[model samples]
Target: MSRTDPQFKLRVPAALRLQIEQAAQATRRSMNAEMVVRLEASFAKEQPLQEKAHDQ
Candidate 1:
């Protein structure tokens, strides 16, 4: 994220935070990037289901 990118404060359970930390370390990314990647992937997963629903 850049200085121009909007920032939002978020709170997650400690367990979840730890999971993110581990994933970030393994992927060699910051916590912020890890969360962004996972969030984006979630949206990608939903896209196909959304299209199926729209078709029906």
Candidate 2:
């Protein structure tokens, strides 16, 4: 939620939203922060697959 970063509005299913809220509460992070961390982790996980694909 920085002024410099592009902002987006997301619409998620109710179940997913509840999961995120619960995770945020457990981790003491805002819902937005929780989502961002999860997104970054997912993208980071993809990089290894992408590197292997390029090596093939």
Which candidate leads the pack in lDDT?
1
TM-score of 2: 0.84
Clashing pairs in 2: none
User: Where is model 2 more than 4 Å wrong at Cα?
Assistant: none
lDDT of 1 at 11: 94
RMSD of each: 1.3, 1.4
TM-score of each: 0.85, 0.84
Question: Which residue runs does candidate 1 get wrong by more than 4 Å?
Answer: none
Residues 1-56, candidate 2: write the lDDT tens digits. 67689887999999999999999999999998999999999999999999999999
Candidate 1 TM-score over all chains jointly: 0.85
Pairs that collide, model 1: none
Candidate 1 structure quality by residue, lDDT tens digits, 1-56 = 78789998999999999999999999999999999999999999999999999999
